[model samples]
Target chain A: MENLLEVKNLCKKYIGFELKNINFSIPKGMIIGLIGENGAGKTTTIKAMLNIINKDEGEVKIFDLDLHQNEKQIKQDIAVVLDDSFLSEYLNPKSINKIMKNFYPSWDEKLYLKYLEKFNLPINKISKEFSNGMKMKLKIATALSHKPKLLILDEPTSGLDPVARNDILDIFQEFIEDGEHSILLSSHITSDLEHIADYIIFINNGEIIFKKSKDELIENFGIVRCDEKDFKSFKKNDYIKYKKNKYEYDVLVENKADFKRKYSISVIDKPTIEDIMLIYIKGEK
Target chain B: MAALKGLIIKDFQTIKSYKTTILFMIVLFTIGGFLNDDIITFIPVTMPLCFEMLAMSGFSFDNLSNSDTYIRTLPVNKKDIVKARYIYILLFTLFGSLFGLICTILVQLLKTKNIGTEILISDLSITSGAFVGIMFVQIFQIPIMYKFGAEKGRIIQLVMIIVLMLGISLATTAIMKIWGISLDNLAVMLKDYLIAVLGIMVILLYILSFVISRRIYERKEI
Candidate 1:
């Protein structure tokens, strides 16, 4: 199948929050980053896709098969690492290996040991004693040992140091090298996604704002910084969202080329994923 | 099957962490029984208690780690997880009963000079009863754990026990009235087949409890 995973009209409602008409798809051999703030329904979407929680309404298809009908077979090819959930904390890496062996038919002991060594994780030390970075590495190691075709990680890089984050990014980069693997990693850390993600699925307040290619976001999208007069002179339809600053207004444009062609403004700063997200959240339409 | 094996191994690892505490308690109780004749009965009771704790502690560890969410991410389904839990509890119960029986006999031989036949039979019955109690405990405890979680389940279990006791009494009286048999007459009439009947009830209860626990877990939002 062209798309490794697809979600359609996914809806989940809590007391005060709801994920409305959520939809996205992950094509093969690509990294799709789920970027959203805390309580933005990123984790909830992941949980629903994996059957961890009962979604109010939705249809999830993995490997072109219905998720509810062929769950076990579908799960054999998917691995996940949740930010705050894992196997028992009382177990060490060695014990985790023993337990994982029985769950996956393709579990590779050699690869697991290699990851433990590469990550500098002690075999016998309980996971509860590991630092946040170490714990993330251990989780990543376990997730990789199964050699799954798809890896879903929820905030795996949160609270991690830059060096550790780079190491994890490097591993994810290597993971998709074979052109058969895909990754759906959700994180508030947009900078990391900027480095490796091919597609960015931005969610705000449980609603998807956009799902655009990273190249399109970095190349076509631009921010126009101008004085009040220049901002007022421009038509409202030219900009997507605008934020008023002390001395200037920063306007987010969908097409830098079209924006530059329309306005005579010279200053069009490049926008990062975070800057785009900030404009969407903090700026007015 | 492999998923179930993985779950069982996870529980074994959790049980292993309590090694020092388990051994210490068992040894302490055994020594206490050897020193005092009155304490003998309670020593075997410790065996069933220890293993029951071992089985239940797995749920506590799972709660602390939020492993149920992790398990859902794996190839395991809710039914297999519940089945694995039941199997783990029963395996430990069997082992615990054997250990308790051996230790009780050894302690009895070491402490007293002559063992009366009647006392021996009653002692054996008590040991068997304790293991049966362990099974019944799981039948009640597993579904509660699956529904409310390991922490809140303890309080719920207490409430369930009281309700269950009241239910059993009312059920027994109703049953006697419907059959037109007094308690004394029924006991005398069923004495020969009491063990077999009880065994069947135990098996049926476990099956029914497993179904209930699985249903509760399948709908639970981890």
Candidate 2:
């Protein structure tokens, strides 16, 4: 299958923190979720892809073109919405319309107006006076109005109420419905990703811990809970990350069906993105 | 370019936000010129100086505030950002020079002086003063801004300008003493060279500032 975005051996280094060699790809028409903890290099990875921050070493290709060599052309099809609104806070939507009209070659004034009406955003209010949700909506509206083929959003759902977040996610779903559009959504909200992401890429300490299809992850990993004695009887290699308490032990197994048949312990539940992340991050340390 | 137009609009909007300050300075300078008639002589020199400070402050604000982060996230490149800043400086300098010329004409009409001679002097003074001051600020501030952001750059820029002015004064004094040339004689000798030489220097400095700013911006993480 052709990929919409491909990152190979991405590396970035700082004094104390290092984004070790990382790799991932998003297939065309798929919504890929980039999940990581607070300081797990989610923002840095997105920045590297956008060329907003320099990478010590690696290659990023979008639409099958080298990112640096064909940056302008690649960016023509790519839209980015960082955590903050990039629009001038003192300017209102009317003023922003005038400014954005001049900036994007494919900017749709009609679509922008439509979004403003749909979102019920005040046309004359300065962006600074906008609520956090309103500002995020405006940013998303501007990003989508340009007819981009690929959308790269970093924590776009952050600081948003559940209703607002769902509304935004619905827009993203609509954007990719045509099979010509793709998205790389980076967020720490694993539940949201679990609901929408076709593929999941988990990162930690600037490294890709796991990249796989959600179905495969769900099918392969199962949460096994049992008495401490039963957990002690299982081999170490069978479990990826496990926790032991006074009375019970909770463990994750790669092969749920086989493990349940062979082991006497109760393999009670499917592993979630959050459960997987918690075990992988805390258990490994 | 469309990007250039967007940047220009952004800069104009920023300036518009500071309208009250610009108006206050213009009125203050006009009054100062009238009160200190002997020293100011005309509004050409006075108005341009005041506007130069405004332009510098505008650029400083653009560099230091949250605006820098906003602008960087746009579709515009770092090189374009640097180019747009220089364009903004040119536009404001021209506006200031034109305003100064109009003020000079009004002052000449009010004084009932030699209108022809006064017009020529006022035009020359305004043009030269705006050009030199604008160039001086751009060349000095751009480097400082690139190295340190606007907040700290403003302080360093003031110190650097003061040092440069003093150095120029001492050098000119030494040249006059060695050559046995009076101030008036030196002015006469340099008058013709000022337009061509200083104009070239300003253009070169502007380009140099752009190159340096681009390099610094490209390396910046944000």
Candidate 3:
């Protein structure tokens, strides 16, 4: 399948932080979750892909069209929701509807009103009076109303209760049900990604640590806990990285089935997305 | 075209949202018209001064809402954003002129005091001066705001307006003194040729400003 979005060797440098040679691809009809610690360049990468910020080096392609050249055309079919809803506080949804209706070629008034109703957003109330969840929902409603094929959401589910988050996730699931739409969602919440993500991309500091399918990550990745003597006996290449405790060493291996076959005596346990990220970040070679 | 319309519509909605501010300006203009003949004659000048305030309000609101990032995500290009703002300045000027005209007519019909042809000429002078002043400020201010953002750009705009106003006033005084032309004669000279020159200059400045702002904003990081 053709990629809905692609970022190749993306690089952006700041005074103290850098997005270093970042790369990722989102296939059509799939949700790709970007997970990272704060200042790990997740926002930077998203901004680069969206051309919100100029990338120092690299290329971004949306629907196989070069982003910089076909920006206006490509942007028509793409929707973005930043951390801030970015709506003027004084403008109510009614006014916003009138303003935004002219912005997109495929704007669906019925869909927008439906989302507003489903989200329980007051049509006449200014955005200033909204709760954070309501603000997020408003943004989502606006994004989805335009009939975009690719949705780029930055921390959309952050700061929401589980119910709110689930509601949003369900909307995303519904969005991709047509098999023609896709989402690139960045969040710190690992469980949210675990529940809805098809592929998980982890970034640490400024670089991509790994990008793997959720099933492959869940089923194949493992943690091996053993004494120092037993840990040293295993080949150095067997595990990607390891953390040492007072009593034993915890090793992170990519493939549990192969690792277990090679060392039948060592115990292997399944690792969660959080566990994998922590071990990758906190553990050392 | 639709994207540009959307942007203009958004800014118009923003202006509408500032209900208190618009109401206050209207009341102030109406009261000024009722109390003083000079105020009625200079309504065009005074109205744009209000619009300058309106422009400032728009900038602050854009910053407050973080609309720059949001606007970029739409189908509109950076150039379109710049164009829309220029269109907005034109719309604001048109609105101000219309409001000033209505008040001038109200002052004429409702009051016993009538100044005849001299007031008409004075009104023209004031209207031309206001158009030049308002456009001058916007031409310099928009590009600066695009480059530096609303906060620092506003300071630059204030300083530039002051400097430009002072310089124009001084230049006018010096020219009149050197040429031995009375104030009325000079106003006549402006009515005949200077308004046309100023109008052309304003258009050129607006075009230049649009280009410069588009460049600044295209390169700006959200």
Candidate 4:
């Protein structure tokens, strides 16, 4: 697949937190979901890739152009939605339209107005007065109004109810329908990713733990529930990770069908994204 | 250029509420001018100072909203951001001086009903002096504000003003003791060249301030 963004060997260091060899790519016409716990470097990774923060070492290429040599040109096609940062609280949507008209050459004033009407956002009211969901919708509307090809968003679905999150997911899905646009969205809400993301990159402790297809994680990987005796009979190599309870064991299997064929365990449960993340973070190796 | 315009527009929108306060200040200044015509002399100093405060308020608002971080992600370079801020300051300073001059003219016309070239000349000198001094102070304050946020920058500005006061006074005393010239005599002697010297100094301060601000912002990991 043709890639929209490619980040390699990205690294950044703070007093206590660091991103170690962070790397990823967003293929054209696809959504790549970035998932991690709090302080897991998801935001840091996004910031570094966008050049909002200085990276200690790395190379970032967007639209097949070197970031340092072509930042302004590349950024023309890129849109960003930060979790806690935005234009300003004092600016109403109308004023924002005026300010943004000067930034992006492709800024569509009519489309922005349409987005406001469609979302029922007030052009006269400042963003500070908006509820959490409304604020998110405004951010999305602003982001899309520029007609950017690549959208890099951090925690776009957080602090949203199910209805709002679904609305946002629908937007993301629609954004990439042209088969040339792409989105990199970071959210801890795994279920949302399941709804739209084609790929998932899990970051843990400032490092990328794994990057897999959504179907691979959802369809192939599973959990085997069995008593302690059955767990004891299974070899250590049989399961990827196992968790022990008082009277039973839950083993994370790489392939449920193969595990079933090799062992007599008939209770292989299909794992959700959360189940996979929980096992990856808490289950024993 | 588009990026610079966008940044300026953003700052304007950030401080839009200050328009009412500015109007209030203008009214108060006008009232004070009517009560005492001598207030006309202070316009060049006070009006410019108020505009400076308003410009700094933009920085405070930017810090509050975390807009700088968001702007960095845009298509603007750090150098251009610094340049836009200095340009905004310059424009505000020029506007302030113009406003003060116009107010001084109108108020003098209303009160005395005759043109006073003598007082106008004196006020012009004071205006030039205050404008140069404001630029000097800004050259010092802006880089500090860019390095630290506007909140901490204000405290540092206070300390810097105190130090500058002490330094200027001591330097003045030493110059008087060495040259044995009265302050008024020295002023008249140097009056011809003061504006020229300060003009050059203002230009240099702008360059230095812009360079320092750009360096501070480029290295900043926002």
Candidate 5:
């Protein structure tokens, strides 16, 4: 399958923080979750891809074109929903609609108004008066109204309630239903991602720990719970991460089927993205 | 260009958003122009000043605080953003100049004074001066905003404006004393000089500002 977006050896540095060499890609028609901790360079990566922040080293290619060289064309096909409402808070939706109509070539006024109605947002109220969920929905509505081929969301559902979050996710699903559309969604809410993400990229402390398909990730990593003494006997390399109590231990193995045959341990469950991340991040340190 | 059109619409929307403030300023300037007995002469001077202030306010809105992030996030390039801002300022300044001219005409018509060559020259001068000031602000303020952001840039912009006004005042006094050049002569000279020199300067400053802003924005963590 062709990759919709490719980021190779992406690197950026700040005074106190640094994003080490990172590489990942999203296939066309796939919804990839960029899973990471609070400061795991998720925003940094998205910013670099959008050229909001310059990269120290590495390259980003979208639609097989170099990001910087073909930035204008690349951007035409892409939509981004940032964590915050970047729209002018003093302006109402009517004003924004007028402004956006001029900016996006494919801006659908009817569709935008439809979304405004669907989201139950008052068209006359200024954006500042919007609730957090309403603002997020607005952002999503604006981003999607342009008929963009790729959607890049950075923590778009962070502060939203479950219903609103699900509504947004449903919108995303509808967006990619065309089969040519793709999405790169960055979120800390692993459960949300678990339902929709086709592929997962796990990051921690500015480094990419793993990038794989969700099914593969689930199939490969399993939660093996056993006695404390049994956990002590297993080598660290055999399992990616593990948690221990006084008498019981829950370990995350890279290859659960192989580990299961070797050790007399009960495989408790499949690990979620959050569980995997917590274990791996702690284990790495 | 569609992109340019988009920017114009966006700027107009922004102006519309601050309708109350704009209306207040317009009425205030209009009334202030009328109340002065020397309304005809004062209109030329005060109108440009008001225009400069309005242009500055518009530029201020384009700073980091208002819509920079959202504009940047769109499928628009840094060059588009820079060009849009410069164009917005130019258009607004033109609007301001037209408004000033209309006010002058109103005052002249009211006073029953003929729209003579001297009045024409003065009006032209005021328009040119406003253009120069707007260009100067664009050239200086855009770069400062790229480096310092809106909050700190405002202070720097104020200092720069004060210095510029003082320099212009000193230059005018010196020229008048040495060359026997009055305000009308200077205005006429500016009307001629601005078209060539100011245009080139504006273009150069715009290019420079665009390059610098793009670099700074690219490097910015946000």
Candidate 6:
């Protein structure tokens, strides 16, 4: 599949934190989940890709177009939803429809109203009057109404209730069902990503820890419950990170099959995205 | 241009939401016409200054709600954002000036038997002075706001307004001394040349401010 978005050697410097040499991509017809802890440079990476924040050094290409040179054209096919609702508080959905129609050539008022109805958002109420979930829904509704080829969402589901999050995830699944649309979703909520992501890009600190297919991760990446003797039997490089508990040593390995073949152990189990993230976050490298 | 329009429309919606503040400003300036003293002189001179206050309130709302950050995510150029704000400054000043003018006319028509030519000329001068002063404030203050954001921008705005007020008076005095024009003649000169000169200056400075603001904001990390 053709890549929809690509980033290489992305670098940004702040007073206390630096986003250093980040690289990743998302293929068309795929949902790429960007998983990272707080302050892990997830939002910064997304911003750099979209040129929302200036990058010290990087090349970002969207739809095979260099981000800066073709930003407007590229943006025409792209829709973004940050955590905060960008809509002015005073504007209702109706007014927003009027305002947005002028910006996006393909803006669909019907689609917007459909999403609002689906999300149970009030059409005439000001955005500030909505609850957190409703605000997020309004942002999502706006982003989706433009018929974007790619959706770049930064922690969009953070404040949403479980039901709303599920509804949004379903919409994402439907969005990518056409095999032309793609999504780059950044979130701390791993479970949501785990449900819909085709590929997972795990970032830590300022670096990409791994970028692997979701199926590959589900089938191979795992945790092994073993004591020190059993853990020592496995080569150090076979596992990415490990933790030593009082009862047993839980080691996070890259491949369950290879470890199982080598050790012939039955304690290996599939690791959820969250489990893998926590291991990387708290475990020894 | 469409993006710029969208940004301005967003700001208009925000301005519309502040109905109470807008009403209060109208009431305050209208009440100024009731005063039978020099305070009325300051009304037209200061009414346009309130445009700065209105724009500042918009900035405050953006800052408080973090909407500026959200605006950056839109599919528009950073320069468009700056341009929209500068346009808003112009619109706000014009609207405030018009509001003040209407009030003054109402006061003149209702309270006074015959509005003398001197009073009309004085009122015209005050309004023109206010327009020029507020335009100056906007030209400098917007770029500062782009650099420092709403918090520090407020301080810079106040300081710049004071400087512009003093600068205008000083320049006027210098012109009076050098040109040997009486105060009445100076008022006529202001009435005749003020809009054309300052209007041109405002356009040039606004363009310059837009360029500077875009540079600052484009490079700024939100």
Best lDDT among the predictions, by candidate number? 1
Clashes of each: 0, 0, 0, 0, 0, 0
Residue A149 in candidate 1, Cα distance off native in Å: 0.8
Candidate 3 residue-wise lDDT, A112-220, digit = tens: 9999999999999998899988988999999999899999999999878889899999999999988899999998889999999999999989999999999999999
What docking grade applies to model 6?
medium
DockQ of 3: 0.73
Can you write out model 4's per-residue Cα lDDT over A152-182, one digit (the tens) per residue?
A: 9999988888987888799899999999999
lDDT of 1 by residue, A1-285 (tens): 489999999998888999898999999999999998899899999998788999999999999999999999999999999999998888899999999999999999999999999999999999889998999999999999989999999999987899989999999999999889999999999999999999999998989999999999999999999989888888889899999999999999999889898887676999999999999989997
Please provide, for model 2 over B1-222, each residue's C-alpha lDDT reduced to its tens digit, 9 standing for 90 to 100: 788788878767756666787788666666665556653454666666666666666555554345665565566777887788777767787787777766655565566555687557756766676667667677877767767877788799889888988998999899899989999997898899877777788788778878887888788776
In candidate 6, stretches whose alpha carbon ends up further than 4 angstroms from where it belongs are B31-42, B113-122, B163-199
Q: Give DockQ for candidates 1 onward, in order.
A: 0.83, 0.44, 0.73, 0.78, 0.47, 0.58
- Candidate 3: where is the Cα deviation over 4 Å? A227-229, A245-248, B113-118, B166-191
Chain A TM-score for predicted structure 1: 0.98
lDDT of 6 by residue, A149-265 (tens): 999999989888998899899999999998999999999999998899999999988889889998898888999988889888878888888988998888999888888888899
Deviation of model 3 at A125, angstroms:
0.6
Error in Å for residue A118 of model 3 = 0.5
Q: Pick the candidate with the highest DockQ.
A: 1
lDDT, candidate 5, A1-285, per-residue tens: 899899999999888888889898888889999999898899888887678877899999999999989987888889888885366676688888888877778899999999999988899888778888888888888888888999999999988999988988998988888789999999999998998999999988888988988988887888877877687898877877777656777788888888888876655578888888877776431
Between candidates 2 and 4, the one scoring higher on lDDT is 4
Model 2: per-residue Cα lDDT at residue B183: 96
lDDT of 2: 0.79
Model 5 chain A weakest 10-residue run by lDDT: A83-92
Root-mean-square deviation of every model: 2.2, 2.7, 2.5, 1.7, 3.5, 2.8
Q: What is the lDDT of residue A278 in candidate 4?
A: 82
TM-score of every candidate relative to the true structure: 0.95, 0.91, 0.93, 0.96, 0.88, 0.92
Better of 2 and 4 by TM-score: 4
Clashing pairs in 3: none
